[model samples]
Target chain A: MTKPLSPGATIGILGGGQLGRMLSVAASRLGLHVHIYEPAANPPASETADRITTAPYEDHDALTAFAKDCDVITYEFENIPTEALDLLEQHRPIRPCREALRISQDRLTEKGWLADLGLQVAPFADIKDAASLDTALERIGAPAILKTRRFGYDGKGQARINAPEDAADALASLNGAPAILEGFVSFTREISVIAARGLDGRVACFDPGENVHREGILRTTTVPATIPHSLATDAVLMASRILTALDYVGVMGVELFVTDTGLVVNEIAPRVHNSGHWTQNGCQIDQFEQHIRAVAGWPLGDGKRHSDVEMENLIGEDMDRLAQIAAEPGAALHLYGKAETRPGRKMGHVNRLR
Target chain B: MTKPLSPGATIGILGGGQLGRMLSVAASRLGLHVHIYEPAANPPASETADRITTAPYEDHDALTAFAKDCDVITYEFENIPTEALDLLEQHRPIRPCREALRISQDRLTEKGWLADLGLQVAPFADIKDAASLDTALERIGAPAILKTRRFGYDGKGQARINAPEDAADALASLNGAPAILEGFVSFTREISVIAARGLDGRVACFDPGENVHREGILRTTTVPATIPHSLATDAVLMASRILTALDYVGVMGVELFVTDTGLVVNEIAPRVHNSGHWTQNGCQIDQFEQHIRAVAGWPLGDGKRHSDVEMENLIGEDMDRLAQIAAEPGAALHLYGKAETRPGRKMGHVNRLR
Candidate 1:
């Protein structure tokens, strides 16, 4: 087996958002330096990172230098530029692999990939043009989501097809970008599996957590999701299967819809997911550290939950209640050092132990 | 009461060792910035700190600039130059107070202060010259330790007088430094309480941890010390008395000797201590964060222990078994990104939950 990264080695992280910020902290705990590569001048992750390359992804010189300095490379976001990643690939290996990123970058590709792997995915149809949209609408019907194949996140880049009459308007909203129509599924709750795979190919999954969304943003994730024991096992097995199939070497957040029949795959994040933030307070090894371990070629840690936690995101005005939130007895607050608190902006999160 | 420091305000930390490194990280988690003012270039704390001022404490310009930039100032170590502290104090307030620093900086001073509080302390006598050493030795007797009054740590600046014959040699070992003769206590065990005092004068103490020392260096600190519940309460009460007497703002590590009679205060650290490192994995709010909260004028967080933990320091050669330690189940490893490993140099620590 390849040797795990020695202490003092650098881990290059693409994208310097909250995920990268948390990942940098985890890497610091493991004696690893993080070089955050982000276009923004002073992104949230830059504060704690050893150094930050405030250059655009298209900058070949910056990408090459960052990769050369790092022993291993990992991205906090899946939407990193292909050219930058290709240049970095020449210097250091990227964890979660380019294949995982490529598949997850496109909604159509991800849905098809999951279906091909014999997984129960949401009913999705690719809409290449008006004719394709019409044909898909005929097959899938209305009350679907018209999401852009690329660059969709936090309920952005998506349009709701509430009725067949709204199809034209929904398509128009995407500005003619390549899209996919996902037929709605009646599910009792949404749960997510934060799974990790070490370089040695051992897949481990944290217990699934039920999620709540407000205004298209994740509000809270409660661990010990009130699902049947068998469904939790199925969710973990499904996540494990996907990770193994992708040959994933880092943490992936698999979102699932708990229907009457079984768990249906909703989406997967090829990096530490927001839903898994509860693990920071609930488990010995949080998702950030788990991702860092996998990418560093270290043995995966036992992520057994020691506490039941409900993680609530502090979006925008939610931070106004900071004093009261700070006084909450069992709350573990993690604030991203963001300069501004714009509406819907994620300022921080508090994991309240239940 | 003064208003609490805002989330984005900077907290200047003096001395960039592991404690500063951890405190910097905790500050980041609270959305606060840390400017680590350390003389050592590329110190472990600098990696995680937002910025580092690598100038000697004697540099007035550097110290002044650091203080001007930070809303509040704190330190990871005692014994900072008085001139530097005076300059910083002109611009910003130093938490835990200079009084606490002064008392803890000198072994003799600390012992006297503890005794003045009506807390049980080991017999200690100030030794200025040869005559004082002889007179103190006559009272405290043989088998005592000759410790430097100031600037000693990890067995440094201290020599043991095991017998009457060794007394001369031990005194000579100190090289004319102001010393203290501490009579050895026949204690069954040593335990430490990590205590905090907020700006609001609220006090909270973590469960006392039984400490084991090897070569005068802390080896392990296990929570739930093998002491009666009564002694634990007494230990907390004693620590509370010390904090209250000092009007201390921030966390302090109070080492105690658990004898047959009761708990005796061995010493106190003005900042977070190695014996309390297990709180990182065991408690809702660790000593570092607790210290930050106190100094920042925020309400003290709940210091309740959620898990039983044993923290072992990885000193020098102890790092050789890193692979084994990393593989151990329920182990949470925290490595200080120090480049070289020398004898007795603290490289990292591991917290293993039982």
Candidate 2:
């Protein structure tokens, strides 16, 4: 991994969702071919990837073949099976490293790790059972969120507590799995910074994008966020600290809560995040390409924004407006090739250049 | 052909070169898939295309199968064999139509067609043999270029006649094939306009880019060409006239010679051209996407340039500068995945934003 990958090298991607789809396109742009490993047939990324292995993550044969063909391995989602990653890493280097994944995959570990860096995160308590849930609720406060320590995203495996009376029901819903109760932070808005740390340890960060979520799903991300310039600089510094701490290589998405006092990190994704999609239209090099460059051990591109952009997610039925969106001037539509339109599914997104 | 192609429809691209590779990427961005038909195995576009048919154009069965899978067919190059196109059009529609290909494939027909339209083309004569070559040299005079009537590109299949004595050698260099002799125009600069005409006959043109050539191969394309505003307007109008006359349905590149009196029509490419590569970084919707939209019957995306950009081609050993170029701020690199590099071969290109 000391030398940059030559053009025509194969990059192995563990997931074949839209992020992987975009990643494949970016890899192709750099003359790097991608081999996608996903269980579903004709996954979104299969359309652009050079090769695809349709097998479950637990299948050792498929994993071995995929690893054997790749110059380097990366994953689109952080929730990849630990056993699968351990196997892949034995054959080829897994970028952003296994340490980043281990921390970001579990809520308790992620929160504790961030807090250890003297960073401001919401106050939280770990709960393993009903008795612990009551104690944690008492310590964290009544208005809190109880989330499973692992495999929780988009409001799944999460329940809100209005008071102590809800603790029993929340613990029962978790079925005694390890969880964390986080007291809600009073914040003005939510924003995310997408930064890439190259193999050379140099970090480049795009302008933080202000985010709006509807029903716990990201709705829109607007650049030139309402945050003051000073606050924006602080956000970038905090993100750099996280990247440095992880000894990270490749793009990482850091979500922050803008409060009256300062910015508080909510969470961090070890791969490309939805909020950074605006960069595809707003910058010379996009987040996907930034991630690819970092993973390929190439120099990180300049992550400077060149124009104002607003990105709106076309979730599920929202894709029905495809024609209308296409007809809109300056709107760049990116639709994932998913056949079914299940509610809340991120079918695609559109970046409108202003 | 009347209705706009629905998202997820497959676009059949005729060639598997860099243009087709980029066209596949653009088609994927719009939720459409691309099936590339290429005679060579592991062609550049094969990395990103959803499907690829690897067989010579003479294989009628392969062409039929490719057309059957695609909703609409478009080509990356103009010289696709007529027999293959004839078979493809039977199963699917070929956009930019057969007329554009028929006229553009032959230098004699293309020049005749342009001159008949009351356009300003260079003084020219058709040379069918050595006798015709001598007669054409006498009429067009020395200081002319003798080019094969078909399949000449990147300065190949061409010879220059400096004086009357050089006419025989120039015609001999063409191997007695049908040729054309054209007197060189005294122009200040070479510029190209990339335009698209939709199914409904609506046309959108990008600002012209000034071109610089090295050994007759394009080296760089700089947007905001050093031309008067009125002349730029005329360039767009001239491009529109060509598209209208052809009843074209796809992107076309119209190369022009900016002279003291007016612009002269140099040539026309019925697909995405090298000079338009700058739009990839300078505009929200690029020439590749515009071509896909025109063929898919979707409304064209905005073609207006938002940033000043200089696009330089990475030909042959120019790829040795990948590290240095990738490190440059605001430079976006695009590499064609060709395993071997040869002099005059287009390996990739870089678009630097100013």
Candidate 3:
């Protein structure tokens, strides 16, 4: 892994969702071929990847074959099966490392690791059972969120505990899974920094994007987030510190809460995040390509934003208005090739250049 | 034909060279699949295309199957065999239409057609043999080019005549192929306009690019081409006139010779042109996506460019410098995934944003 991969090398991606689809496309831009591994039939990445293995992660043969074909392996989602990653790592190098995955996969591990690094994070308590849940809620406070320590995304696996009376119902939402109570942080806004570290340990960070959420799902991310010059510099510094501490290689999205005192890290995704989608139109190298460059052992791009952009995600039924969005002036539409339009599925996104 | 193609519809592309490879990537961004028809095995487009038919154009069955799967058919090059096009047209709509192909396939027809349209083409003469070549040289004078009427590109299939004595060698170089002698025009610089027309006949044109050639092969294209404001306007108007006249339903590259006399029509390519590669990083809608939008019956983008960019072609051994180029700040590299490097063969391109 000391030398960068040559053109025509194959990158194995685990997960064929929109992020994988985009990662595949970005790999193609660099003359790299992508082989996608996903259990779903005709996943979105299938349309863009050079090859796709539609087999469950539990299938050892498929995972081995995918790893054998790739020079490097990466994943779009952090919660990949530990056994599968264990097998693939034996065949080829898995980027961002298993350490990043182990930490980011669970809220408790990520919070504790960040706190150890002297990075401010939300106050939290781990709860393993009903008795522990009540004790954690009392310590964290009534106005808090009880979330499963693992496999939670887009507001799923969490319930609000507005008061002590609501604790039982919030715990019910977890359905006996181990949870963590995270006390709310009073911040002016949410912002995310898409940062990447190359094999040589050099880190590059895109301008943080101000995020707006609807129903707990990311709705829009605007680049050049409205903030003071010092805070913006602090936000990028915080991301670089994390990338350096983790010895990370690949793009990571660091979600931060902008408080009056300083920036508080809300969460970290070990792969490309929807908040960085504006980079597709605003910068020379995008988050997807940055991730590919990192995993492929290529030199990192100097992440510089050339234009202000606002990226809006097209959630499920938002696709019904595809024609309208396509015809809108200054709209660059990117749609995921999904056959079904369920209520919460991410259909695609559009970046409007300003 | 009136309705725009929906997400997930397939676009059948003829030729799987670098142009087709890029076209496939662009179609994917719009949620469309690409099926490439190529005679060569393991073409560059194979990495990005959803499907590829590795059969020669002579195979009507393969052509038929490809067309049957695609909602619309478009080509990356103009010289597709007539019989193959004839068979594919019966199954699905072929865009840019047969008229554009007919006019651009031969030097004689293109020159005559442009002249007939009252466009300012260079002085030229038709040569069917050595005798005709002699007659044409007498009329057009020395300092002309003798080119094969069909299949000429990248300075191939043509010979230069610096003086009347050079005429015989020029004609001999054609090997009795029907030829045309184009008299040299005294132009300050070469510029090209990338324009597109939708199914409804609406036309949109990107800014003209100034081209620099090395040994008659395009080496670089810089947008915001050095030219008077009025001439730039005139260039777009001229391109719009041609797309309108042919009822063209895809993107076209109109090369113009900018002179003291004004812009002279040099040549026209009926597909995405290499000169338009700058748009990939400069504009919201690039030439490939614009071409896809045209043939797919979607509305054309505004064709606005937000950045000034210079696009350099990676030809032959230029690829050996990949690592150096990849590390350059503000440089966006696009490799065609071509395995072998041959002299004059396009391997990829790099767009540098300014």
Question: How would you encode candidate 3's per-residue C-alpha lDDT over A88-187 as one tens digit per residue?
Answer: 9999999989999999999999999999999999999988877887888778787999999999999999999898888888888888887888999999
Show the colliding residue pairs in model 1.
none
lDDT of 2 by residue, B1-354 (tens): 689998879999999999999999999988888999999999999988889999999999898999999999999999899999989888999998999999999988999999999999999998887787788878888899999999999899999999988988888888878888999899999999999999989999999999999998999999999899999999999999999999999999999999987999999999999999999999999999999999999999758889999999999989888889988868999999999999889999999986
**Which stretches of candidate 2 lie above 4 Å from their native place?**
none
TM for chain B in all models? 0.98, 0.99, 0.99
Worst 10 residues of 1 chain A by lDDT: A323-332
Q: Taking the tens digit of each residue's C-alpha lDDT, what string does model 2 give over A1-354? A: 679999989999999999999999899888898999999898899998989999999999999999999999999999999899889989999998999999999999999999999999999988878788788777778899999999988878998999999888887888777899999999999999999999999999999999999988999999989989999999999999999998999999999999988999999999999999999999999999999999999999879999999999999889888889999978988989888889999999999976
Instruction: DockQ each candidate and list the results.
Output: 0.83, 0.82, 0.84
Q: Tell me the TM-score of each prediction against the true structure.
A: 0.99, 0.99, 0.99
Report the Cα interface RMSD of each model, rounded to 1 decimal: 0.9, 0.9, 0.9
**Candidate 1, residues A1-354: lDDT per residue as tens digits?**
268998888899999999999999999999999999999889999988998999998889988888888899999999988988888998889998999999999999999999999988888999988788888888988888999999999999999987788888889999989999999989999999999999999988899999999878999999999998999999999999999998899999999999987889999999999999999988888999999999999998877999998999999999899998887756789999998999999999999888
User: Under CAPRI classification, how is model 2 graded?
Assistant: high
lDDT values, one for every candidate: 0.92, 0.93, 0.93
Error of 2 at A89 (Å): 1.5
Superposed model 3: Cα runs more than 4 Å off: none
List, residue by residue over B122-173, the lDDT tens digit for candidate 3: 9898887778778888888878888999998999999999887887787777
